[model samples]
Target: MVKGEVCSEGLGPCDDTCNSKCTSKYPNGKGSCDSISNSCKCFYQCLQPKPEICNVGIGTCSTACNDQCCNGNCAAKFPGAYEGHGVCYNVGPSIYNYCVCIFKC
Candidate 1:
């Protein structure tokens, strides 16, 4: 979640000082962490962060996404279990599949 406010003077281009853990996905000075403003924002772009706080009855509404979703929001669409073998098995109608025992049930 990049805040809209960014200090370009002291920080130099965001790319140069980008925090890898915080702002690695974007290039071109995007995903800047504004220490003064305490917010993060991508340059010339808009992206809503995942709803960390969900309203009543909303059950943590899925994250705003474009085309294909990833990370947080992905659980909303494909609920399943992956055993590190790159296999995902859907448990039921909702997200979150039961983990299968490696040995046996």
Candidate 2:
């Protein structure tokens, strides 16, 4: 997975107001919305015990939700992803940096 990067690159449903766009320009997310700058900034972080391979950051766009957020098996759905996810845990200037497949939890 990629290190020192944010993965909320997808632009999801504007009405949903939960998962918005991640930071990467070429890569992607299944995500979480945090209160940043008084905005419900929705984005994705990588998940782990690091995968056997790496990442494919799916649903990192505005398409995941039409009415609401998309929920289910991410690995089973989006594959062949060329990009990588983020780090799981960090000690310097990074928190749980891994982007997980977002589902109703």
Candidate 3:
């Protein structure tokens, strides 16, 4: 596994405060303040590959609906992607839901 920096927030100079904030956000990750950037950076082992955003469109919370809309659209747009590799997530309130697809880059 490779260690990766997932989050970084600038909070003035390096101090105990930066360490505390990083630990609070990621319990399993290490937080250190970089003097060069003057930011608190969180480091952790990234087991899974980072997913790339494939497509975003209107969709419902139902898996069937999302599968039809998101999977179909993602396959059409990115033909090289493996079949059923696209995953759709429903976000926003119940009144207005949107589909977001994350697939292999």
Candidate 4:
């Protein structure tokens, strides 16, 4: 669990007004707080709707999708993930701030 930073390194604002939520970069996230802004970044990986964890060597990716979005088990299938079948597919660059997977089935 990440604890939001209360101190602002003397830049200013140390009161309740300065209270912010922790931010995370990865989905199925496995890291710590990313204090970039005020909104609490949803650590998708920690919750669900996990993002792509690519197996670069195999040119394939895998993850579990959000149950609310699809009726299926937490998937670990290949890319081209399909709903009701448990799979997720991704495309584009490797340095995405967020992954927008397309599911079919």
Which numbered prediction scores highest in lDDT against the true structure?
A: 3
| Number of the predicted model whose TM-score against the real structure is largest | 3
- What is the per-residue lDDT of model 3 for residues 1-105, given as tens digits with 9 covering 90 to 100? 112323233445667787676667656657777654466665443334654232334345464555567666656654564232344443345544445443333
Compared with the true structure, all predictions reach lDDT values of: 0.29, 0.34, 0.48, 0.27
List the candidates' TM-scores in order.
Answer: 0.17, 0.20, 0.33, 0.17
Residue 27 lDDT in candidate 3: 66
Task: Return whichever of 3 and 4 wins on lDDT.
Answer: 3
Compose the digit string of candidate 1's lDDT tens values, residues 29-65. Answer: 4456655444453432222342111111112212242
Clashing residue pairs in candidate 1 are 2-40, 2-41, 3-39, 3-40, 3-41
Better of 2 and 4 by TM-score: 2
Estimate the lDDT of model 1: 0.29
Candidate 4 segments exceeding 4 Å error: 1-33, 44-78, 82-105
Off by over 4 Å in 2: 1-4, 9-11, 19-41, 50-105
Q: In candidate 4, what are the lDDT values of residues 1-105, reduced to their tens digit? A: 112211111123233422232222332332222343322323322222433332111123333333322323322332234321322333334322222322322
Q: Tens digits of per-residue lDDT for model 2 on 1-105?
A: 333233343344333434334333223453444333233333444444443333333333233332123223343444335222222222134332323442211
Clashes of each: 5, 13, 0, 6
Instruction: Give the C-alpha miss distance for residue 76 in model 1, angstroms.
Output: 38
Instruction: Give the TM-score comparing model 2 with the true structure, all chains together.
Output: 0.20
Model 3 ranges off by over 4 Å: 1-13, 47-105
